[model samples]
Target chain A: MERIEIGHGSGGKLTRDLIEGLFLKYFKSPELHSLQDATYLPGFEKIAMTTDSFVVQPIFFPGGDIGKLSVAGTVNDLTVSGSVPKFISVSFIIEEGFPISDLERIVSSISKTAESAGVKIVTGDTKVVEKGKCDGIYINTTGIGDVKRELSPKFVKPGDVVIVTGFIGDHGISISLSREEFEVETEIKSDCAPLNSLLVPLFDVPGLRFMRDPTRGGLATVLVELSETSGLGVRIYEDRIPVRDEVRFICDMLGYDPLYLANEGKAVVVVDRKDADRTLEILKSHPLGKNSQVIGEVTEEKGVVLVTSVGGMRRLELLEEDPLPRIC
Target chain B: MERIEIGHGSGGKLTRDLIEGLFLKYFKSPELHSLQDATYLPGFEKIAMTTDSFVVQPIFFPGGDIGKLSVAGTVNDLTVSGSVPKFISVSFIIEEGFPISDLERIVSSISKTAESAGVKIVTGDTKVVEKGKCDGIYINTTGIGDVKRELSPKFVKPGDVVIVTGFIGDHGISISLSREEFEVETEIKSDCAPLNSLLVPLFDVPGLRFMRDPTRGGLATVLVELSETSGLGVRIYEDRIPVRDEVRFICDMLGYDPLYLANEGKAVVVVDRKDADRTLEILKSHPLGKNSQVIGEVTEEKGVVLVTSVGGMRRLELLEEDPLPRIC
Candidate 1:
């Protein structure tokens, strides 16, 4: 009867009792137990501050895990706004039955990733929940920093050049094939990696019109958002778009679009046509951007189009149905 | 087939795919994707920011919910030392087959709780994972704020008075009976509530030694922590500690001690005797504190001790095990 069970997560009276009786007693603080949506500081600027929790299933997929994804997800949020990545707090909700060896491995990866990106895990907290009550483990990370640069939708012009940091859908396809059973899967590794190193280098360059990581809905979605945000149309050369043969093959077999498959280590940066070559060159030297390319150009047209390999043009549609393997 | 499922929670390829495909693309920024442990921001002070994902079952538990618990858990860490609660970002990992009505209810509760404590939900992200792949639903809330206040261990005083707001053990026992069939069942309500209104009002007061909310490990754990932190012993009166009849009945039947129970709507304030009366008065009038009382005193004895009803003293030992009721 005293044993912990899955029911504790019921959000019922029992949940509260556990929090109030045991957890809260030790974590005591008025602001903490205030139980608000967001903690109130009584002072903040006109800027936006946000935190996100991530629990991606695998610790290491083709591209990422709960750890790296947790970090990348937060960084991308700040990056698009021209804000620099800053300090982060990492908390792990480890199940009692989780493998300690795996955790150590994950932590080492996290440490290495943070070091490469030049951020620090200034503080950390850990909690162990009973098995079945949680997945193997969940990682929640929060980040805060200053937005030193100014980025606006206005900077995106109709004549801008649309450049991608590297190949699209590698991370998604790699992960999908790795996690699930599939035929015609390729030997592609995930494109999961950090982009801040490239981001800082790019900020010093001119004509950096717009930047976004094509993560979830992939290139199409990101392009759609930018077009909507910038009130501009976009056209792309399908032949020039970067996609590993493995990724393309898998997407074709599964009826998934590489354009919509996620990429952890890639990004879409819009720069002026004049600066595209320079930008591409700089990105190429970075390991994550070695496959960088100029896929398309921004336009004043009202819709998005892709030039087919046969020289025909087609409209790139918005995502309507869930492409489950899109994450790969 | 596109629905997010339990397998996606496996921390494998699909999880990576999900983030890269959906989450990363839309949330992309130049500063993100370094896949690091912590992000570095040069200007502001280094902050350890974090977000938590919770899917506690049985929404209307004896104490709180995934919503309230999410907020409390994050804020507690921020309030653990240098900072006050400032801003938070929330994300929802919802189960597709779960009840939308319940979701709405949880949202409303979260909003109300946040508003009451003056915190804003400012920004949030939502995603639908498949049924069973997730518990009913999971919530990820992240918070950030300034760490201007100095509540370090050095602030602890040897002769401080330990004031507990209202009762203990009720929250845990209530949840136990409500969530599961226990050996000795009793109907007891949880003390889950926000305590900032009471505590903030006392911030400007003098001789305010220290404060904590006895949550997971309850009063016993918190006192033990204080003893270690301040290098001072604590002496608490058994009679002075508050306990409700229902909680006592259930604990007695289960061979549980009320002192170690969790509390949401409670706090332990360490202050000098001079500020004790003023502190109690302020706490008594608050909605969360109808039965505030002085339960113990700090001592030079260097550990945790309880003055028993038989006029004999006993040491409060550390907890060796966890009381878990979890929802993945």
Candidate 2:
């Protein structure tokens, strides 16, 4: 009805009209129209839903694009819950004058990702803003899955050993290196791989406490969440945490902590000490989890502490600030 | 890490990074990481999952914003499935420099909508792009619910009477009129409201068939889809379809049909003729469906046909081109 500009995306009355008039028009599914925080699904013994947004600069990075990440990230969220990731709804916001080629590529990537995950892209959306309004692209993917196993966000507790699926901070570091405009002799790669394959074995274990992928804010944030959820503390030794040499070097040069950087294809698992050894063994056997390590143990205290390499103790706070803006 | 340009949202490699890095980081629910299409959720029972996107220009229209629409649209989708709305996930892609006030309004709207629908925004994501990349804001919301009563996409059949929930084309007409360039006064108001409250009475009917909302591509697209999915055709009398006088005048003036124009808060129901009268009665009582009307009948054919006001017949083809480009 009007020439769209960046202002339209603002949460003003016109924005509302666009959603009501255009979005709701094509996607008439009832669950979405309620405009609720979470769609209450009554029939399942367990339910899984996930939300994710892409703010990657360049839209496509060295290894993957926002489209792939949007789907993968959402599916993994559901997968770790031991739910079968079933449906995903994608939303895309495009700036005007964007090349159609890129849209096709992204859609193709989404199709490929969906096929790989054995899911269907039943419905999706696209919106366009005028030129000079926003960045290149941003993607939001919400996923739904049905709980297939007896899993609970309730099992994590103190004294459980923490296991990381693979090497840490590759994703964040790779992006940083590319963005820093610094010359590096060593080649670095992002660990943006799928985790469903790795989860297959972990689900076979009966006493697995909890599992979460460490993306933005990395292992620190997830461990803190685990502790807060379980009302427990966590203690991790700096020496034991795995870090790729390239990531470590970049962090050193950038004065960053690999611990706090994001990792695309990694997970941090908290399990009963009895199940700890088996979990690590299981993770190490998988390609995605090749650098698997025992990063920490749940603590009885209410505060999260990091046992340093110098034997000094300090707290690992929730990443107080975005270490690298839009690294995801 | 490069200053995001419009090319990134083009759906290429850059889009993938934005997704993998940012989305997976904050939202990191396992199912999300799988990068799937339709998530392979567990159980094939009566579950409803709906997807909608908000690309409203001038977000925060007269009555609502994209946030409200994000939640409302999803809720309506589930309601159409004869399910009580439950949970919703929200995702946002915002351009840099957008005012925070508008976002608060939109988010507040979401909270309000969720509360009203008795659903939760269990998960959400946000992304900020540089200027010149996106409009102000765009939202994608996905809603899921458990169907209490038996419902399926194949519920429509021959001998079923088509019932519309309310006046048609109000949303399209209102939005068009509301646009900045449109310089005419019109009493037409967008029909943007949740329909879950109206559905309770009709869902349990002895022979209620399929149900859907005619949003985008309007009534014609919805009826065509109904025909295809139900393996049945439909014949509608133009004179019987409900349209506010002002809306019809606006459409006529603009060379648009109420059938092809969008309706925000509306639905098309195919119910047993035995229950058609009762369905109309129930719909008429609900505030959201007060103008409910019987519009057509399902048939054994495979496509939709519209009987003109003068008794001539014309095939109502599904929309093949983007009418009202970027209308959403």
Candidate 3:
């Protein structure tokens, strides 16, 4: 019943109480309480570090909230970089008058996600602004992961095949509806989740070339980046890429390309043709990736081209403008 | 003549353009473009990691802007934790209609500060939200530093000397007046500079026990925390503590305790009495620590006690409420 007051982020007694009663209670660890400005991570020789600031509007949406999105987003970022997430630092900017209950729920979600991903919440900070100065809460999660191998476009080749883990655009569409700006409704849920467990199995595939979570610019953007960075072209079979009917319907109504919509829980993997079937099988075995499919292949050409269902070809260029701002 | 649009944060073409044109133009480095979701930090066996979100109002202030504060703040956090600040990840949440010029200025400041502090801006993220949903901008910086030695409360003991780097309350007073909420005005400027250079010397002192940048809750709050955490008492002579005349004058008029005001560029160091003189000498040699003074000592009792200017004793308790929010 104790709602969050401005004092709770004051770096004073109330802030300490909130951290101890809520954060410490959930994220109990020795390094977390090292009583230093920064937590020490020992034996991290070659580590992958990434940072993301999640500012999704409405805070919560179908299947996930900002807390879950934050954890999954950073973890996926690290996982795609060929590292298993080991530690994370979660910092929050809470608006005054925000409900403590909501914060508790968010923290609980973070704990569950971090636990599932086998990452420790190591060090963090919280700051509160006056009411109306900020929305509800914006979380910045920076994670450090243990690198098992180096993954980069430098390793991507012309004969690699692209695999998408499950349906795309669910997160973007779900969050868009949650905002209620369009007055439209759907049963679509966000695909927000950590792909580390699902990805661990695919690392064993010797032909694995590239992996990336198409979060912000979705599948097309990732392909474009891959093409541009690695100087290789891509050809995707549009009919092969999975899109939930509800998501496709919403996109059609809005005239939005599903390829450009953000996805929180999906990954686009590029592997050699020889290992494509095995990679797809590994992804399909995971509950979150049951809809996995081989969607495309890398080409010697210099741009991303999509083949239509009727055998027509369309160019999937980089996203030019913002259709959604707070979709993440 | 260009301004930042919502598309620039959409993580699409415009976003990519912004990164290449603005961010990469200034923060260009190899690690930044490693083309991985996360940058790999090699040879970091023992490192310290910390994160902070800076929402300082009026992004540009007298002595520093949000960008400089972002870099310096994170660097100081890592520095005080006994680490040589090395790499940083900068994340920004900008309002859609924010001026591109202001952002350029902020980024320019960040580049200079990071360069001076001997740290690299390795990874980053940018998110744009609709205007009015957020203030002009908020920056979150997470840093990784190499830990040369362990710094903790367990190292503190009775008879340790408490030394303050320089004048207290300068940053708080300067920012308070910058808001122009109070009618009164003064010439106080923010003491906002990176203290890593000033601190490297003290690390060599055999008796050095603890060091912290007295930021949000200021000197009193830090003393209370050190006392509580170490299970040792702190006694400071009020007369020996340094406060600029303008800062003290403003504090007097506003009925604010200078001890409780923030100091962005100052440090509170505790060292064994045997090495107190040597530490003080080293600190005073640095420009940022020219006014360093030994104002307090650790005691056998277990709470913070302040010696009044009138030969009286006053108990300094933990900060109860926020006198000012978003000061840094």
lDDT of each: 0.64, 0.69, 0.89
Q: In candidate 1, what are the lDDT values of residues B1-328, reduced to their tens digit?
A: 3455443432334444554554444333332343222222223343324445654556568656667776665555454433455555566655555564565556666666665655545455455554444566667666664554445334667677888888787767766677777665445766666565566666666677667777666788778877876788899999899998777777777777887666666777888888888888988888767788898888887899999988998998656543534421
Task: Please provide, for model 2 over B1-328, each residue's C-alpha lDDT reduced to its tens digit, 9 standing for 90 to 100.
Answer: 5343332332223444555654444334344444422233334355666667777656765555677677777887788777777666777776656665565566667777777777755665556555755677778887777676555548776888988887888877766666656666767766777778888678778888777777666888778767766788999999998888888877778888778787768888888899988888888887888888888898898889999999999898765443454444
Lowest lDDT block of 10, candidate 1 chain A:
A36-45
Can you tell me the DockQ of model 1? Answer: 0.14
Q: Can you give the lDDT of residue A239 in candidate 2?
A: 87
Which is the better candidate, 2 or 3, if ranked by TM-score?
Answer: 3
Give the number of the best model, judged by lDDT: 3
Which ranges of candidate 1 are over 4 A from the true structure? A1-50, A62-65, A123-134, A181-187, A325-328, B1-55, B75-83, B181-187
Docking level for model 2: incorrect
Q: Tens-digit lDDT track for model 3 on A1-328?
A: 3687888888998998998889887887688876466989876668889999999988989999999999999999999998889999999988888988999999999989999888998899998887776778999999998888788887889889899999999988988888776766567889899989999777788998889999888899999999999998999998999998888888998888899999999999999999988888888888988999999889998899999999999988888886888777
Candidate with best DockQ: 3
- Looking at model 1, residue B227 earns an lDDT score of 81
Model 1, C-alpha of A265: deviation from truth (Å): 0.7
Worst 10 residues of 2 chain A by lDDT: A4-13
TM-score of each: 0.82, 0.81, 0.98
TM-score, chain B, each candidate: 0.78, 0.83, 0.98
